[model samples]
Target chain A: MDFALEVNKLCKAYKDTAFKLQNVSFNIPKGSIVGFVGKNGAGKSTTINAVLNILHKDSGEVAFFGKAMTDDAKYIRNDIGVVFDTVHFSGELTPKKLERVMKDIYENWDGALFLAYLERFHIPADKKIKTFSRGMTMKLSISSALSHKAKLLILDEATAGLDPVVREEILDLLLEFVENEENSILMSSHISSDLEKVADYIIFIDNGKIILSEKKDTLIYEYGIARMKQSDFDTLDKSEYLSARKRGLQLEVLIENKKQFTRAHPDIVTDNATIDEILPMLTKEESK
Target chain B: MKGLIRNDFYNVEGSMKLTMLAFIIIMIVLGIAGIYFPPNSYLASAVIGGTLGAFGALSGTAMQKDGASKWSRFELTMPISRSDVMKARYISFILYILIGLVMAIISALYFMR
Candidate 1:
C-alpha cells in the first residue's frame, strides 16, 4: 500500500523537559483517515508539528506522500491543507481581500469553490473576521483549506468547540474528500466521537509512547470490556488482558483477545468495545 | 502555501484593515494639523510613522501566536509544508506594510511639499 504519511521513531523534547514523543512509528495508508488520538498534553500536537516541520524533532522521520519531511521542505507543502482549532485571520482584512491574496499563493486555488463554501457555511465575505463567531471562523478556515485542492487534510482540535451538528458536517466533508481514494487525512482531535465516525485507523498515545495503533473496527472488536463474576476472575490469566476493575462484587476485564479468552474461559461475560474504551484500557497505567 | 497565506491573512481579519485605516487617518490628521498649527516637518513625520510602526511591527509576531496554538496542528494535516505557510505569511506582511507605508508617504509628501 502507498502510505500517505509515514512516521518512524519520531521524538522531540523541550530542553530539560520530558520527551514529547518516544520512538513513535506508524504508517497511514493512502486515502485513509487516521485518527490521531490522545488526551490533552499527550504529544498529539507535538507529533503533528513535527510532521509539518513546524517544530524541529529531536530524532525521528516523517514522510508525506513518500517524500521526506525536512526543515527545508518546500513544494511538498502545497499538497496539504491544515485546519486548526482557531482561525487567526488577520483582524486587518476581509475574506474578500483574502481571496485575492490566496489566489497568488496556491497554484491550484479555486476562487469559485472558496466563495461557494463561504456561502454554504454562511460566512460573509465582506464582514471582518473578528466579528465572526468561533464556528464561523472555523468554517472560513476549512473553506480556504479545501478550496486549494490539497491532497492531504490535517486537522488539530478543529472540532473541539464546534457544535455536534457542525462537527459532523465537517467530518462528512472529510469523508467525501477521501472517497476519491487519492486524498487522505490525519486528523488530531480530542473529540473521539468525531474520529470514531470517520477514521479508518487509530493510533492511541499516552505519555509520549504509542500505547495502541490499529484499524478502528479491529480495535473496537479486539479490545473488549469483559464483565464477569468475582469468583470467575480468580482463575483467569492476567497476561493477555489490559486491566480489571471490580464493581459491587462484579469484575470487568479489558482484554486484548476476546475470542481466545472467551474460548478458554467460556463463562466470562464479554461486552462490546468502543473507540473510547480502548485507549484507557490499553494504556491504563501501562497495563502489565 | 498561497492558500495558507491567504487563509491566514483572512483568518486574522478585521484587525488589519481597521488598523490600516486608523493609521492612515492619524497620518492625515497630523498632516492637516501641521498645515494649520505647523510643526517641523521632520517631527510631524516622526509622529505619523511612530504610531503606525507600533502596529506594523506586530504583524509577524501576531501571526506566530496561531503557530503556537492548537491550529498549528490543524495546519499540519493539510498538504502544505510548514515553511510555505510561514513564507506566505511573510509575503502578506510585506505587502500590507508596503501598503501602509505608501499611504503615509503620500499623505506626508502632500503636506510637507
Candidate 2:
C-alpha cells in the first residue's frame, strides 16, 4: 500500500506534433522496481518529463513520498535521481569535476561512495566524458545517480545500447539498490528481457495510452495465448480473452487466466505469455 | 544555484582560457605598437575593446553548450527552481563581465604608463 511514487491523470500535448500523453497514471510501490515498457514515441519520455516537471503537464498530479510536487515542494527532488538515454553532463567535464558539481547540488551527496563506484565500475576519474565509450558513459551515469543517495530513481533507457555484460552489471546494481527497502526505481526501457529479469511490476504503454499495468508474475504466469480453430474460438466467451487475431483460418487469442481458460475449455491448449508476447498481443486487433 | 553557476563557468572555462590567451597576446603586441607610435596610440584601445567583447560572448557560449547537451532540460530535474536557474545564469554573466572589466582596466592602466 505504501508507494514511492504516484502519478494520476497526467496529460501533456505538443502544438507541433499530433502525439500527446493521455490520462497516464501509475504507482511505484516502495522498494519495488517498476518497468515502464513502450515502443519508441509511445509517450514514455514525455510522461517521465511531465513527472519531473521538465515538461509542463496539461492536467495531472504527481506525488513523491505522499507529498504533492508543487512550487514549495521543489525540495522533494533531492531524493530523486535521474539518468537519461544520453549522458546529460557536458563532455568537457571529467568525473572528478562532476563530483564537485554534484556535491554542491545534492544535499546527500556521498563523495567517498561516488569515488568507490567510479573505481568499482572501472571509470576513469580524470578522463573527459567525451572520451568515454557508450558503455562507460552509461556506467558513469549510473554511478552518479546512485551516489546521490536517492530514494527513487527515474532512468529513461539508461541500459540501452550497452553490451549484454554491461547491462547485466547495471541490473545487478539496481537489484542491490532496492535491497534497502526504502528505495525504488522507475525505468523506462524498450528491452523487455531486462524487465523480465528485474522488474516486479510492468506497465505497458502504446500510442500515448497505458494499455496494461500488472504484476510481472501475473502477466508471465496467468496470462496465456490460446490457438484454436474458428469453430472452437466461437464457443468461448468474450470475457475470457483480452484480444484475438486470425491467421490462416486459425485464431490466436490472448487469455487473461490460463488455468481458468483451460478448465472452462478442457480441449483448448494455452501457452504461458512473456512480456514480449503480451505487449503485441494485448494491442493486436481482434479477428474480423 | 551555486552548482548551476559553477557548471556554467566550467562549460565556458576552455573558451575563457583561450580568450585570455588571445587577450594577452593582443595586448602585448598592441602595447608595444602604442609605445612606438605615440600620436596614433589607438592600438591598445582596440585590443582592450576586442578582449572585452570576447569575454561578453563567453556566457552565451556557456548557454549554447547547455542547450546542445540538453543540460538545460536535465537541470530542471534537480532541486533548484526555474527562477533559481535563471538567477544563477545572470550571476555568472555578471561575473564574466566583471572579469572582462578588470582586464580592461589593467590594460588601460598599462597603456597610460
Candidate 3:
C-alpha cells in the first residue's frame, strides 16, 4: 500500500519535563483520513510536531511521500497543509490583504479557490481578523491551508473551540477535500464523535505511547466489551482478554476477539465498544 | 522563503504603518525647526534617533504578537524549511534597519544643509 506518511521509531524528549514520545510509529495510507485520538498532554501534538520536524526528534525516522525527511529535502513540505488550534494571523490585516501576502509565498496558490472558500464560509474579506470570531478564524486558517493546493493536510485539534454546526461544516469540507484520491488528511482530535464520523483509520495515544492503531470499522465492530460476574471471569482464559477492569461485584473485559470469546463462552454477554470507551479502557492501568 | 517574509511583514503591517507615520511627523517637525534654528546638526541626529527608537518598539510589538499567538508551532508545520524561516526573520530585520537608515540619512542631509 502506498502511504502518504510513514513514521518509525520516532522519539522526542524535553529537558524540563518528564514527558517523552517513546518509539512512535504509524503509517497514514494514501487517500485515507487517519484520526489521531488522545487526551490532553497525551503526546499527540508532540508526535505530530516531531513528524513535521517542528520539534527535533531525539531518534527516529519520518518520511513524506516515501522520501526520508532530511534537512536537504525540505521541499516536500510544499505539499503539506497544516492547521493548529491557535492559528496566528495578523489581526490588523483582512483576509484580502492576507491573500496578497500568501500569493507571493506559495508557488501554486489558487486565488480563486481561496476567495470561493471565503465566500462559502461567509468570511468578510475586508474586516480586520481581530473582529472575526473563533469559528471564523478557524475557517480562515483552513481556507488558507486549502488554497495552497496541498496534497496532505496535517491538522492538530483543528476542530477545537468550534460549535457543533461549524465543526459539522468543517468535517464536510474535509470529506470534500479527500474526494480526489491524491488528497489525504491526518487530523488529531479529542472529540471521538468527530473522528467516528470521518476517519477511515484511528490511532490512539496515551502518555507519550501509542496504545492502538486500527481500522475504524474493526475497532467499532470487532472489539467487544464484556461485563460479567468476577467468579465467572476467573474461569475464562487470561489470554483471551486484552485488558479487564473490576468494578464492585462485576468486571469489564476488553475482548480482542469477540467472536472467538463468545463461541468459547456462550453464557458471557458482550457489547460493542465505542472509540471513546476503548480509549479509557485501554489507557487505564490494569487492575488485578 | 518569500512566503515567510510575506507572513512576517503581514504580521507587522500595522506596526510598520505606525512607525512610518511617526517618522514622517518627526521629520516634518525637525524640518520646520531646522528652518528657524539655523539647521542645528544635533536636531537631525535626535530626529533620526527617535525614528530608530520607534522602529525598535514596533519590532518588539510584532515579536510579542508572534510569540503570544504561538506562531512557531503553526509555522514549522508548513512546507517552508527552518533555514528559510530564520532567513526570513533576518531579512525582515535587515529591512527594518535599512528603512531606518534611509530616514536617518535623508534627515541628516536635510538638516546639515
Candidate 4:
C-alpha cells in the first residue's frame, strides 16, 4: 500500500536539554487517520518538528508522499495543513481580511469553502481576531486548515482546550476529510477518547521511543489485560504476555491476543484494555 | 509570497499611519522653526531628512513584530518556502525605504525653497 507519510530512524537532541527523539519511525498509509498518542514531554512535538524540518534532526529519513523532504520542499507543504496547539492569526485582521492573505499563499485555496466553514462555525468575518474567544480561534484555525485543498493534516493538540461539543464537531470534520480515500491525518491529541472516536491507528510514544504502533481496533479489541493472583500468574509462560505489573496480591498482564489467551486458560479473567490503560503499563518498568 | 507580504502590510497598517503622522508633525515643527530662525533653515532640512529616515525603521520593526508574534509559527507551517518568507520581508523593507526616500526628497525641496 502507498503510504502518505513515512519516517525512518529519526533522531534529534538538544544541547541545552537532555530530551531527544530517539529513532522515531512510523507510517501513515493512504486514507488512514493515525492518532499520535503520547504524554506532554513524550517527544510528540519533537518528532513532528523533525518531520516538518522545523528543527534540524541529528539523523533520520522523512518522506512525504514518497518524496524525500529537502530544503526546497515547499511544493510538498502546499498539500499539508497544520494546526498547532496555539492558534496564530493576525490580531489586527478580521477573518475576511485573512482570507485575502491565504488566497495568495495557497495555489489550491477554496475561498467559498473557507467562508462556508466560517459561517458554519458562526465566526464573524468582520470581527478582529484578537477579540475572538479561544474556541472561536480554534475553529478559525480549523476552517483555514480545511479551506486549502489539503491532502494531509498534521495537528498537534489542536483540540486540547476546546469543549466536548466543539471537539465533536472537529472530529466530524476530520472524519469527512478522510472520507475521500485520498487523504490522511496525523493528529497528536491528549484526549484518548477523541482518538478512540476518529483514529483508525494509534501510535504510542514515550521518552522519545515509540512503544507501540498498531491498528486501534486491533489494540482495543484483540489485545486485553489478564488479571490474576501472583501464584496463578507464575505458571503461565512469560513470553505470552507483553508486560505485566504486580498490584498487591494480583498481577495485571498485558496479553497480545486476549481471545487466544482466554481460550488457552478459561479460568483467568481477561478484560478489554483501553488505549489509556495500555499507555501507562507500557511505560512502566517491568516487575521482577 | 504575495500573501505573506499582504499579511505583513495589513499588520503594519496602523503602525505605518502613526509613523507618517509623526513625520508630518515633526516637519511642521521644523518648518515653523525655520521661519523663526533663518540661520537654522539648513538644519530644518537635515531634521526633516532624519525624520523620514526614522520612518524607514518601521518596516524592520514590523518584521520583527511578525517574527516575535505567534503568527510566525503558523506561517512556517504553510506551503510557502523559507525563501518566500525572506522575499516577503525584503519586499516590505524595499517598499518602506522607497517611500521614506521619496518623502524625504519632497520635504527637503520644500524646505530648501
Q: What is the interface RMSD of each candidate, in Å?
A: 4.8, 1.2, 2.1, 1.3
TM-score, one value per model = 0.81, 0.96, 0.93, 0.93
lDDT of 3 by residue, A165-252 (tens): 9999999999999997888999999888999999999999999989899999888889999989988888987788888887788898
- Judge candidate 2 at residue A240 and give its lDDT: 81
lDDT against the true structure, per candidate, is 0.76, 0.89, 0.85, 0.87
Query: Model 3, B18-100: lDDT tens per residue?
Result: 77887788778867776777766566677778767766565566667678777756666666676877888788787877787
Which candidate number maximizes DockQ? 2
Residue A122 alpha-carbon offset, candidate 2, angstroms: 0.7
Enumerate the candidates' DockQ scores in order: 0.33, 0.71, 0.57, 0.66
Report the C-alpha lDDT of model 2 over B2-113, residue by residue, as the tens digit: 8998888888989999999988887777777766777244766776787678898999999998987778988888888898898998999899988998999988888778
Query: lDDT by residue for model 4 over A1-288, one digit each (tens)?
Result: 488899999999989999988889999999999999988799998898789887788999999999887658888888888888875887878899999999998889999999999999999999988789889999999899988999889999999989999999999999999998989999998899999999999999999999999999998889999999887888899788888888888889898899899988899999999988888778886664
lDDT of 2 by residue, A176-238 (tens): 999989999999998889999999999999888999999999998899989999999989888
lDDT of 4 by residue, B2-101 (tens): 8998998888787888878877887787677777877355675676667667767877777676765578767777877678788888898888788888
After TM-score superposition, the amount by which residue A238's alpha carbon in candidate 4 deviates from its true location, in angstroms, is: 1.6
Pairs that collide, model 4: none
Show the lowest summed lDDT stretch of 10 residues, model 4 chain A.
A279-288
Model 3: CA > 4 A from native: B30-39
TM-score of chain B of each: 0.74, 0.92, 0.85, 0.85
Count the clashes in each prediction: 32, 0, 1, 0
Instruction: Give the better candidate number (1 or 4) by TM-score.
Output: 4
